[model samples]
Target: MNLTIDEIQDFKGKYPKQIWSLFFSEMWERFCFYGMRGMLVFFMISQLNFHEKEANLQYGATQAFVYAFTFVGGLFADKILGFRKSLFWGGLLMIVGSLILATNPHDFFFLGIAFTVVGTGFFKPNISSMVGQLYKPNDSRADAGFSLFYAGINLGALLGGYLCIAIGKGEIFSSIISESMRWNVAFGLAAFVMVISLINFVFTQRSLGTIGLQPGHPESELQSAPMPKWKEYGVYILSLIFIPIIMKMVSVPEYTDYFMLTVGPLTLIYLFYEMSKVTAAERKKLWAALVFILFSILFWGIYEQSGGSLSIFAAKNLNKDLLGLDPNGVNNSGGAFFIIFLAPLLGLLWIWMSKRKIEPNTIIKFGLGFIFLGLGYYVLFATRLFADLQGITSLNFFTIALLVITLGELCLSPIGLSIMTKLSTKNLQGMMMGMWFLASAYGQYVAGIIGASLVSTNENASNYDALITYTEGYKQLAIYAIIAGVVLILISPLVKKLMQGVK
Candidate 1:
């Protein structure tokens, strides 16, 4: 029953059986992740009594740390724990964190968030790296595999995004669960699913064969180890030790800013140090990957408004009835809903285009993603024009905007993951994946700042004032997105050269 790495990667058909296992594992993990994400700003504003701007900053800081830790997690996985152990450890932490939040979200909010942040850092990047390992280098089916994997991620997001916020807001289970107990139930749901994710991995990881084994461990002799057991134990101990530090930084937005500023530069310096050792071709590909990373930060900064400013906007200025559902739930889940349906179709489209030798290169796809992103934000801005006298906008317009944003995300995110693996050497795969998610951390950090700037400083500002402010900010974002798209397209040729035929 045990398949070697070659046997697994060389399997017939569109995907390896192991992909399904990873898929389910990632699905439940994403449910936990997006569920917690959907609740953060809402919880801060309503329960923690944070102002809108302050909540935005805190949300950004928390999400940023969650992603930034991914780089650290990836490094540890690359150097010590390997993907399998890293994922298990991360899942355990996430379950504990969710339980902490469920115990008393209002009292222990920052502590719970800090644990989840660290947990996510370990869980997020390594699994995706493992998926990359399932495919041989330059395997044409890799994109499709990633695309399918992306759908599983969105499936989880759709469920958790809708359910968690809906439950926490008392929109669902109002009869059985009192308002006092709703938030607890929501947090509890995340923990429960995390347990499922970890258990799924535990039972199915054998299918992965040698794919996630620790660095320097040969596939032929799985028991042989180049690294010391003490080093592996050290990683676990250090991660736990850093939890309090993470808790402190996330609690104070200013401290997050300091951490962000220092961490990014230090990561770059370290990457360059590694780059000095790679071949010229690999270095060029790494440069191409860097370009993608840089652009992604901008893309996510604009796209991630859904969690911060857009969440608040849905609460304050959007119509509550979209088929009798809460607008906040719709805002949180809408993109994922669309992606679940769209990712496969897009993947097929890419395959079709490739057969004709006319597939747009990854750079062009990245550019197009930004263009769609711009259009999506423009639609969001236009919602202000449709506002009723009460300043509440149509949910239809909101849904349409989500669809457009989903299109943009489909173009960039999955492709970005696929390309990161394609571009990095085997030894650097985990690091490059970490860097990609770290870019998202920067994006999340910037999104918070942008969201905060748009929020009215006056505590008594009306919904109409909020609509005006947020729409104008969205308009600015649309313009920037369009400009970035155009610039990326213009420079695509240069980037293509740097890719060195990675398409």
Candidate 2:
């Protein structure tokens, strides 16, 4: 399996570094993305004066829209701009958005969110798709390379949590910086990291060669056939300008759901159109992809609690002030520190298995992932027996819980991207990627809605009383998520067959 000098030289000057360079580029981008996400909900509730319930919903909507639009972005890249250009444009827009986000002025909040939505729309899916482009068909290194890419993402996320959020959290601990800089520090860091990402990609673009091409060029582009993708994306963008009006029309209590209602149909229509163009074998792949999509919703619905319920859990119950760390702190840092180390070890584990030709099938791995996730949460569920939910608990409980949760994340999150690439038909890869991201969108939306119940209050209740009422809701979700994971494992065999031997 060792690459010879002559073989390695073949790739030299022909696109000098493919996988690692893209890996680093995505790493920095996730740094900016995750850093901001770590602070978003608390920033809303604390700084903006949002009710706990209201802030969570808004956070949910913001996150959901960001991902849902990746559906548009994947199409846009596949059909129009190509991945490199789309990524560059997305990065540029995100820098601008970060500048807007760094400001504390109320006027900037919605504007920042708007810019970020469009920016992420162009960013998220295209980069991962390009990772698949790094390998030749059936190259065993493909999944391992993606695992490396996942490690890169966590590296950034871990840094963002420790360096970015913890730095901003300084206000809670010390008055060294004015309140003016407290919120801005995280955004400012995001801006700086993103600029580095932009520079890295701009310089490395030539090395990627034909990896992210649009649908049509020549037979040299891939097969001697025509291709198409972004028309649906264009329509989607056009539809986005009307979403405000549509949201108003629905008149639902939760405007976020109304918004999702509008976009959900568009996602379906796009999928239907993509499916119309594929063969039976490829279509079976799509069905398998559908099973992944369903399972993904379940997976992320619980895992995404890191940004919502679990985050709140850290603030209220966890020993936030442990070892002199402040309760109202920003970084939410240590958990990610464990992730930084664990992710790579897991990456190497996967690669080691691949080299031995002992790779687990995708669905089986997915099933195992759920068991790990359930195990992680049930640890917290066990803590309830020993610790009082009605009183403060030691942060050690949360730290241990997150460590286990991160292990579960290591199992599933990395592999999901690899699965998307394998399961896709060439014509529908972009669409399938978008659909995959949509599961995340829905999961965030659900997390937000669920988080609200965890802390929501009745109008008649005192604020303190309402908070107590809401935390109980979180307890229920903890139980619910644990149960859902088991059900997913039970159904794993059915999904494995639907995959038709893709693994």
Per-candidate RMSD, Å: 1.4, 4.8
Put down candidate 1 lDDT per residue, 367-392, tens digits, no spaces.
99999999999999999888987788
Model 1, total clashes: 0
Model 2, 394-472: lDDT tens digits are 5666567667777776677777887888889875666678788988898888877777777644566543444345445
lDDT of 2: 0.68
Please list the C-alpha lDDT of all candidates, in the order they appear.
0.92, 0.68
Query: TM-score for every candidate vs. truth?
Result: 0.98, 0.85
Q: In candidate 1, which residue ranges exceed 4 Å CA deviation? A: 216-225
- Candidate 1's TM-score: 0.98
